[model samples]
Target chain A: MFETLSNVFTDNPLIVSFAIIGITMYIAYKLSDKLTRGRIHGSAIAIILGLVLAYLGGVLTGGEKGLSDISIFAGIGLMGGGMLRDFAIVATAFGASFDEIKKAGMSGVSALFIGVLLSYVVGVAVALSFGYTDAVSLTTIGGGTATYIVGPVTGAAIGASSEVITISIAAGLVKSILTMIGTPFVAKYIGLNNPRSAMVYGGLMGTTSGVAGGLAATDPKLVPYGAVTATFYTGLGCLMVPSVLFLMTRAIFG
Target chain B: MVIFGVALLAICMLIGIFFGEILGLFLGVEANVGGVGIAMIMLVLIVDYLKKRGKLSLPAQDGLGFWSAMYIPIVIAMSANQNVAGALDGGPLAIMAGVAAALIGWLFVPLLSKGGLQTEETVEENTFIGGENKNVRNIK
Candidate 1:
């Protein structure tokens, strides 16, 4: 009877994947609410947990697909594939409101542009100093500075090596974590007291999870405004990084 | 009725991906560019248009809500798919680049916020209501 039930679950890999994610989310949120008192958002905590699991899976299986390398967890490969990841991200825009977006105005718009550019510049300089002189690597890593999602997307689109793409992702993850932890500490000093400033902050920060989590800590009220612009920032980064930015990097580095 | 929302999302996604691929082709890139982002923009636009037309029903809204709620889980899965261990093996360059970008971005916050158009008093009331209502609805 136990073997039959286990076989049934293993046969339906996606279902098993969902169950694992569900349990992970439950634990992550519980940790957020009880342990951290919601100072850190559940999503950030979940990502950390997921990363740890991935690391462990890599060690245990000595395989590339992380936890999915284990047969029972094979569904994780499909669940975490690009298709579903893209679908979930696309679905998030449903919650956005045009009326709310209009409130941010010109400053918010310019902040997005400036934010992407500044991050790219900083990322490129760091990449160069680290002796990664190739245009593809520089552009991909620069895009990663914009956001983790952008990093991988740009890298793949421009045919960058898998190693470079992974590094780019790691770079983006570090940015997201820092943004989450650093927001509240610097909020008052930066005049992040109002919705407008929050919107500008979001546009500048560009990482949605980071901005959302940080704003939640600083002022729960500011999260929405920051989130809206941060979403736009991601979209803008996605559109810009692989095309125009890649061209620029090629021009300079070549 | 909830299926209608899913259908709508599917239609928008198809169109978005098509355009994204076209954009990629134009730019000479092999991979799809901004497909997900484009789909998101389309969903937002389409939903807003439907809402304004009063064509969106409660069930359809529920469908959107269901998927929106799935956001955290999907993000977790995506993060899990990343090769963090491999990235770490490449050394501290990745970590340095990320920290530098974040810090420099933070340093510019005050400069960007200095000359904003709206005063806090006038913009406060309307934005507060909109922001709070959104938070309640999304719950993320």
Candidate 2:
């Protein structure tokens, strides 16, 4: 009976994957409510937990694809694939109000450009300090500072090496985690209380998941405004990093 | 009825991904660019239009509500799939670059907030509707 049940679950990995995620979410929420008194959102905790699991999965299986390396958890790879990720992100916009978005106005628009440029400059400076003199490596790493998505997209467009692309992704992931954990703590100080400020914050952050998760922790209502601008930021970064940013980096470094 | 919302979302996602691929091609990149963002824009437009016309019934709203709340879980799952360990093992430069970027970006928030539109009354009005009521209930 046990073997049959195990086989059944493995056979229907997607269902098991959902069940596992659901249980993890429940525990994470409880931990947030009881342990942190809701100062930290459950999503933040869940992300940390997921990262830990990913690390452990890498170690235990000595394989890529994290937990999906295990046969029983194979469905996790699909569950976490870009298709579902995009679907979930798109679905979040259903809650945003046009009135609120318009209220963000010119400040919101400017924030997007400043955010991308600022991240790129900082990324390039760091890459230089690390002794990477080539424009391709510098541009890829710099773009990663904008967002993980932007990093790979930029790297691929400009013909960056796989190692550089991986490093860029790591940089973006760290930024996302920082944004998620830091938003609630700084919410009050930065006046992230209103939709306009939220939009500005999102534009500055530029990482959609980071901004969304962080704003969710700060105030659920702020998520849509922040998410909308952050989404735009990614699009802007993709357009700018490979062409304009790459050329600028090449000119400076070469 | 519940499926209607998901169906709409699926349709929007398909359209968005298609456009994203086209944009990527135009830019000479091989990856999908801003597909998720485009899909989101479409969903928001469609939902708002439906609401304005009373075409969105309670069931459809409920369907969207379910997925809206599911955002966090999905995000968590997506992050789980990323190879954080590999990145860390690659080098400290990645960490340094990321931290500097995030910190500087955050430091600029106050400056950006200073110049935006000033609507004290609107902020107060929205606090009631946006902060406390419908959207937040499902989150906690």
Candidate that would win on DockQ? 2
lDDT of each: 0.73, 0.78
Candidate 1, residue A162: lDDT: 89
Q: After superposition, how far is residue A36 of candidate 2 from its true place, in Å?
A: 2.6
Give the per-residue lDDT of model 1 (tens digit) for A1-254: 98998798789998888999989978987998899897666666766787778777777877766677777887887787767655655555676544545655577789899999888888889999989999999999998878878888898888999888888887887787678667776877888877678778988888866775566556554654676567567667877889888998899888
Judged by DockQ cut-offs, the docking class of candidate 1 is acceptable
> In lDDT terms, which candidate is top?
2
Model 2 off-target regions past 4 Å?
A1-3, B29-33, B115-140
DockQ of 2: 0.51
Per-candidate clash tally: 0, 0
Residue-wise lDDT of candidate 1 within B27-130, one digit each (tens)? 65544554555676677778888887888887887676666556556656755655556545546878898789888878888887775434555544543221
